[model samples]
Every structure is written in C-alpha cells, then in structure tokens.
Target chain A: MTWVTFLGNATDPKIGGIAFFGIFLSLVVFLIGQWLFKISNGFFLFQPLFVGMVLGIFILWLLSKWFGVALPTFYTAAYKPGGDILFWFLNPATIAFAVPLYRRNDVFKKFWLEIILSLVVGMVISLFAIYYISKGLGLNNDVISSMLPQAATTAIAMPISGAIGGTPAVTAMACILNAVLIYALADILIKVFRLNSDPVGAGLGLGTAGHTVGSAKAVQLGSVQGAMASIAVVVISIVVDVVVPPFAHMMGLF
Target chain B: MASNATQAKNQAPEHEPAPILQQMAIFASVLFVSSLISPLFPKSFPVPTPVIGLVLMYLLLATHIIKLYQIEKMADFLISLIAFLFVPSGVQMAASLNVFTEHGPMDGVMMIVTIILATIILLVVIAYTTACFMWVSRKLFHKSTDVE
Candidate 1:
C-alpha cells in the first residue's frame, strides 16, 4: 500500500493506483505512528527497529494502494526508503535527546573508562568477528561489517562503515535488524544463561551489544537497566564515531 | 548556616528544586559542554555534544555529586525520543522502489548477506562476554567478602 492513500489507503488500500499521493499518505501514517508512540507506554523506545518495521508495513500497504504496485514481498529485499514526508516528521528528534545528556553529567564523566572500554570491545569483537568469520564462511567483507555497528547507533555506524569501505546501506539495514531481533531475544538469552539479571548487567549488554533495541529490552527488565542502556547507547555511538575509523585505518583493514 | 541548623528539626531537600527545572538545567549544561568539547575528539564521532557531555555526566553521577533520581524523568525523555529521530531514514529504506535497478543487486545482495551474518555472530559473542563479566564480578565479590 502506497502512503498516498493511508487513511487505510485513501479510504481503501485495496483500490491501488492513487498515482501521485504517495508522499501525502506517508505523512499521514508518520503522524499516526508518532501519536501512537506518545501514547503506547513508551514501548517504541525499546523496540525502535520493530516500530520502524511496523511503520514500514503500514506504509507499504498504503503505497501499494496509491501506486498500483504490489507491496514488496521479501522483507529484506523491500526498499522504498519510506517517503519525504516521513523524513520531515523525524527531523525534530534531535531536540528531544538533550534531557539525559544534561542530567547524567556525573555518570558520563566518572564512567568514561567503562563506557570507552565497552564500546571499543563491543565494536571490535562484533566487527572483526563478523568480518573474519564471514570471510571463512565465504561471505564478502561488507556483509560482515555491515553488522559490526548493528550493535552501535545508526548515525555513527553508517559513516564508520563507509570510511572503512564497508557498506553504509547494509550497516543501516543491519542496525535495524539487530534491534528488532535482540529486543525479541534478550530475555531468552538472559534466562537461558541464568544470568544475574541485574540492571547494570542488562543495561551494559543492551547498550554495548544490543544498542537501542537492547535498551528497549533493558527497560522491560527494569528502569535501572533502562538508564544504563540509554547512556550506553549514547556512549557507544560516540565511541564508534570517534574511534572506529582511525582504528580501522591503523589496522590497515580497509 | 541557618538553613543547615534548621534541617535537624525538619528535613529540607537541598538538591532538587522540582523535577522539571532540574531536568532543564541538566539538559542545558550537557548541550553547552558537548558543543564546547566535541572538537577534542576526532571527526568520526557520530554525535555532536552529548557524547563528550555524557563523559562528564558519568563522572559527576558516579561520585555522588549527582544523583540518578534527580534526572530520572529526563533520562526517560531522551530514550522516548530515539524512535522519532530515525523515522526518516527508516522510511527512506522502506520506500525506495528501484533500489535493485538503481544500486544493482550485486552490492545490495552482498550487503544484505553480510548484515545477517554479522548480527547473528554479534549476538552470540556479546551474550558470552557479558556472562563472563557477570561471573568474574560475582567471583570477585565473593572473594572480597571472604577476605573481609
């Protein structure tokens, strides 16, 4: 369904071929999704990747309605970049992040050692392990490292991949995929391992390894974990941005 | 001095004014510091201020100079906003129709394949490492208790 018709498809997504209303429809869906986010007990914070995907589905149905095209079938293969209207709605997001960065000043300064350590270790193990193992598996480098920062934030991960000659598109894609999968899998992993299930433990794992998606999982575990996870996301994204490229260059891996 | 003496009779909260104002102050401080110090890091860092500012926050919070409860709502607020920020990029990915014809299947194919493998392997390693740390910390905690 094309976005142009997303009042459940210009009053009916099945009626495809609304032609030029695609952007308009995406805007409507984005507004609805944003509202849903505000009202949904804050579930999207933990499951952003899934939230994005759910939005995508609605968008696909709407676009299909408007454009007379079948919705993209393969989940991984589908590609439309959503729409311009959606992008516009999201632009205000950077304004909202100032809260914690302000209050958590003490945590950020004192925990520098841990934050840096975790991000470096997390990115290194994740990136290289994927690279070498995938090479052993006969997959290309881009395929592996694209998932490297999957555990990291998108803004930093995308360009880091690009600088190191990895695939930015895939990096973006993998980050989303990991968030969804990890958010789903975190509990089982914790329970299966009989892990301590402490907030710090859950938070670090979520922030360092799980990224935003993991944080979502962390929140479900408890608020302390959520706090840790949130801080971790910011720290890891910063670390990945500042450290990965030069480190990648120094190692001559690119 | 007078307020300190009066505190024995009735406790007054010195640290927090109200949740909202404190949150605003915290936010303002971080943004200012991050913008000022962001340049100390290399060009590759993804975010502008909060990254550096976060380092500062961690230091203050851990030292008892700043308390977590003071900024709880503010922290939650940041987490809440994460979803909306990525909507544009997510939408772009969900909507781009001619990607195969435009970017070609070879690079895109290779890219998707790599991402899948990386994510699976990453999850395993992270889970393992976290368990290891938890084990180590527990063992160390026990050892310290025994010594005491």
Candidate 2:
C-alpha cells in the first residue's frame, strides 16, 4: 500500500489517518477561521476559535454523510487520538496564564478585596442561575453540570464538569458559547448598565462572565482593564474550583 | 515600580533572547512537575493540576526562582497559540451531534436560547454588581478616612 493510503484509510488501526489527519485538519480549519476573522475586521462574533470549531464540525459531518465515512469508526481511529494530544496541551497553556497574572501581581494586590467580593457574588449568581435555568428547561444532570462552569475558561471548566459528572464536550461547548455571547453583547450591557466609567469593574465582570474571550475584549478597552480581566479569569477559576463542587453537592446536583 | 519599569526598558536592548531550547526545557519541567503532582490528589478535589501548575509558576516568579525574562517569550508564544490547542477538542464536538439531533430541533433551539439568555444576564449582573460594590467600598473608605 502507498504512504497516502496508509495515512488516509480509517480501517487500518496502526498506520491510519487518525495520527496526522486531525492536526492537519485543525491547522486548515484554523487558517480558514483566521481568514474569516481578518475579513470581518476582528469582529468578536467572527472569532477564529469559534469559526474554526464550527467549520471543523461541519466538515466532519459532511465527510460522514456525503462521503459515507463511518463516524464512530473514524472517531475512534483518527479524531480521538489527534484531538487528545491537542487537548493535553491545554494544561500547559493554562499554566502559561500565570505569566500575565505574575506580571500584574500589583493590580491583584491593590484590588484584591474588591476582586474577591465581586467574583464570589458573581460566581454564586452564575451557579444558581445556570442551575435553575437548565433545570427549568428540563435538561438532565449531565447537561446542568456541563453548563454550571460555562463561565470559566475551558481548561478549568472541563475538569469541573468531569468532577461533577458532566461531559467535557458539553462543558466546552457551553464555555465557548458563554464567551461568544458575552463578547458579542458586552458593550451593550456596559452602556445599558452605565458600567463604562469603571474599567476595573467592567474588566472583572467581563472576565468573570466571559473568561479568556472577555479578557480579549477587555484588552481592547485598555491595559488596566485588560490586566484586571486577566486577573479575574484566574481568580474566578480558582474561586469556582474551590466552591462549585461543594455547592453542586449541597444542591444535590451530582 | 516606575524605576523597575524603566530599568526593564533600559535593559531591553542589552538583554539577549533566551535560547528556544532552554525556554522549552523550562516550560516542560514546570509542566512535568504539575502533571506529577496532579494525580496525587483524589478525583473529587476541585482544584485540578493545571491550576496547581499555574499557582506553582506564580510562586516561583514571586520568589525569584524563575525570572520573568527566562519564560516571558515562551509563555507568550504558548498563550497566543492557546486557541489553536483547543481547536481539536472543539472539533470533537462533532462527535456529539447525536445529542442535539436526539433531543429534536425544538429542544435544541430552546437550549441555545436558554444558554444565550443566561450568559447575557450573568454578564450584566456580574459587571453591575462589581461596579456597585466598588462604588460602595469607595464611599465607605472615603468617609472613614475623610479623603477624596
């Protein structure tokens, strides 16, 4: 068999397409997303990450449907391995977040009390809001758990979901959706609520509600706002990590 | 802080870039340590190891064990590419298409609407609440101290 066939064929477990295809496809999709974002003038809704995800999903769906590829077989053979490696990198990347936090340690100290109070209140409200809303919508526990940590970054949210018995994919989906929604609507919300004057407050809210994407928006606002947002991302993650599981347990969510 | 900032700026031209190999090694060592200690905790522990890794890095920096100059470039590069790392998992969402289809289109729409609404509410509430707290605190502190 030729080298191309060895890499493309789904049935061949050892030398199959799973090893390389996912990385290649991811890069291609990323480029497409970047192009879309560039042409769209860096519109938040046109974020390359979200674009790439949707495109990747659609392409996979098309492959499965039009080309008669067996999804289950392909998933186990190709997607899982490739995706797993990339997912593993999220850990180190998350660790890299410390660089920013370290850089802005003074800001953290200056507003530490305000940051803590805001995050605590925001997190409580977020948890309760997601709980009741998803429950009222008749969603199951897994879905509820997945959505609970939606306000956090994916690296933080995914494990929280696992600890709480939710699927990581659903949690990831919710987190991304949360970020996109906040990114798209943050300005309007700020204007409507008259939050334009308080950059630190705005940054904390953005980070607490929107995580990394929100921080990106905060960065656009100004350096102090960006720093505050970055700090919020870490603070909120740590707060939620320490508090959510117990809260979920008390609520009998698990 | 001003002096430190200026010093950093002045040192910029003289500072040589840390070799890529050394930077990678530092990153890998931190990651390795994080992974090593993460599994020691029970499954129910809320704080995951990556977070622990982050805290460790922060502590190292605070204590001057790891200088900012050593890892700044590598860390920035990794963070810039962070979204790229997440794409694979995002792609894996394709596998869960059955979840939406199985629940039917109406339910899916409801789910989407519910999530969007919740997110907006959360953002508004969090931002406003934080602003309010800051305002209140400033008032309280100012009144007690008799300062502007």
Candidate 3:
C-alpha cells in the first residue's frame, strides 16, 4: 500500500527499535528460508543454497508481476554501495570450509599422480557439457562468464564473475544455478557415466566445479570425495585467480 | 603422503600442542576474521574481496602459516552451512524478476548472454588445461619409467 511496500524501502532506520525489528525480521526470514531450502534439499538434492537462490528469484519474479511490489533490503546492495549484505554474510561462511581445503591438500600430496589425472578428466567432462549447453541455449558472455566459475566455490566464483565484468547479481544467480544443477545432476552423471565412486573421482567432479556446495554433496558420498572437494575449492580458486585477470585483460574488455 | 596426513595431523601425535576444540576454535576464528577482513580491502578489480580472502587462506595454509587443526571447526561449519547461505540472495531474485516485468523482459538479456558466454569460455579453458596437464603428466611418467 505504502511506497515502502510498493517500491521496497531501504532507508536507514535508527539503530534501536529498528535494530530489534531487523534482527527479529531477519530471524523469521532466516527460518522460512531455511525451511524452503531444506524441503527442496531434504531429499539431499544439490545444495539448498543453490535451490534457495532459484526459488527466491522465482518468488520475487512472481510477486512483482502479480502485486507490483519489490522485495526489501537493509543496505543498498541491490543497487549501490556494494553487494547485498547477505552476500557479505555468506562470504564469511566460505572460510568455514577450511577443513575440506586442508584435507584436499593432504589428498593431493598423497595421490599426486592420481588426483591430477582424475581431476583433469573430470574437469574436461564438466566443461564440455557446460559449453555445449550454454551455446546451444544461446547465452551471452556475461551469463557464461558467471557460469564458468560455477564449479569453483562461491568465494572464488563471485570475484571471478566480478573480475571479467560478469554481474555479481547475475553471477550470484549462476552460482546458485551451477550449485543446484551440478548438485542435482552430479550423482546421476557419475552413475550414468559409470564413473568410479572413489574419492578422487567424486571430489574432482564436485569440487572442481560445484564449489563448496558440491563439496558438501561429496561429503554425503564419502569422506575421500569430501576431502578432495574441499581442496579443489582452494585449488580451483587459485586456478581462477591465475586464469581470470590475464584472460580478461587480453580480451581487452577491461 | 599418507604418513604425513594421518600422522602429522593426528591429535595425539605424541606431542599434542593444544586441545582439539581449542584448535578448532582458533581455526574457525581465523577463517571468520579473514573472511570479514577481505571485503574491507580495495576493490580495484571487478571481483569482490571474498575471492581474495580465499586466495589468502590458501596461501596461509600452503605456507604453513595457519595449520589445519586450528581451522577445522570453522571449515566444517562453513561447508555445512553452504546450502543455507543463499536464502537472502534467493529473495532478491523475486525483485529482479519484477523489475524486468515492469521494464519489460529482455531488458538485461544482453548482460545475461555475456555472462553465460563468459562461463562457457572459462569452462573451455578449465577443461583444456585439465586435459593438457594429464597429457604432460603421462608423458613425464612414461619417460621416467623408461629411464628407471
């Protein structure tokens, strides 16, 4: 009814009652989001984070069309200042994945030969599939760039999208899409291809592209895959770091 | 590698340095602090700071500046929470969809297409690199075995 409700208000409210209200509202939203995330994810489909983004987008799209309203934000991350504060919160959580990263190091060290070869094989397969699909569907550079880092963890992918001028907002969407698509389809693909369910096999597939969400899926598969996925998160991050900037600069898009 | 991983990281490796929980706490704190601090840095590039934080974490681990035990708890928690973290972002999709409806569809299709194309190109590189590494490794392995 009000402008606040219609256009979405992000005016800086005073830090007291608004603070309590913000926290309470955030908590409530958190719970509901958690519930939706879990319901789709309860069956252990891809990561709930991925599903949440898609579902959120779909919900927002429907709401606006039906009611002529927009969702609310605390900060102007939607338009200015920076990315959504929620993204900032998610960014910190990325660090929480140090265990997998550490284990990945151990796995790579131990099975250096096997890990390398298997990773290469997995990497090739995932990339080809993505490239062909995107092209066949006729997507543009920005969307594809965002999708390119899909398999990498979010912490790394977000910037990868940002680096080459891929929209973080859209990159955020791609991150979710990649996580969901891979998380949902990985096991099937593995089974379909008759790929070994070994740690190296599973981890390479998930971590190399699925990012952290994929690693979580790998954990459900087995510890070895889980460990490798963690390290892959880091390794892939490193890979992106080296690969993105030079490529972007060379392309002269910058 | 096995010996280093299982033995070096074992909690009771004959000379326990700290409680496991303490180790985990320290590790988690490092991750959290690093993650928070990363976004604070200058963003000269289009990429966000969290990516920088990831690289920094990797370097710290690789260089032995921050050992695994210290960060295990944090790592585990973050991985576990990965799915739930996207909720707020999901909510944004709702609004973006509406904006398009108001402005009309395909308003940002070009932006979308460019992003999608970039992803394809990046993946092509990743796949190609992976294949190349495999080929080189195999070549080196064969050469080493012949010499041996």
For this target, which candidate reaches the highest lDDT against the unseen true structure?
2
Across A1-254, the per-residue lDDT of candidate 1 in tens digits comes to 43333322323346633333434434455566556657885453434445555676675656455666655532122332234433433222232322333333333343435445654666667666765655665655544444455566666677778867777776766676566556545666667655434434456666665665466556656644555566767766765665566656654556
Model 2 chain B: lowest-lDDT 10 consecutive positions: B139-148
Question: B18-82, model 3: which lDDT tens digit per residue?
Answer: 56677556545555666576667555432344555555666676666766655555566666666
Q: Write the per-residue lDDT of candidate 2 for residues A83-161, one digit (tens) a residue.
A: 7767787776667767766666655656678778888887888788778888888887877777777766676778888
Local accuracy by lDDT, each model: 0.53, 0.71, 0.52
1 or 3, greater by TM-score: 3
Task: Calculate the i-RMS of every candidate, to one decimal place.
Answer: 7.1, 3.5, 6.2
What are the C-alpha RMSDs, in order, of all predicted structures?
8.4, 4.0, 6.6
* lDDT of model 3 at position B57: 66
lDDT tens string, model 2, B1-148?
Answer: 4344345445446767678788778878887897788778765544566767777887786676877777878877776776677677667766665655566777676667767867776676677777777777779775221111
Best by DockQ: 2
lDDT by residue (B1-148, candidate 1, tens digit) is: 3232233113225544347877668666756776777677565555645445555665565454655555555656655545444444555555433442344666556555655556555545544554454455457654211100
Docking class of 2: medium
Q: DockQ for each candidate?
A: 0.19, 0.50, 0.27
Ranking by lDDT: 2, 1, 3
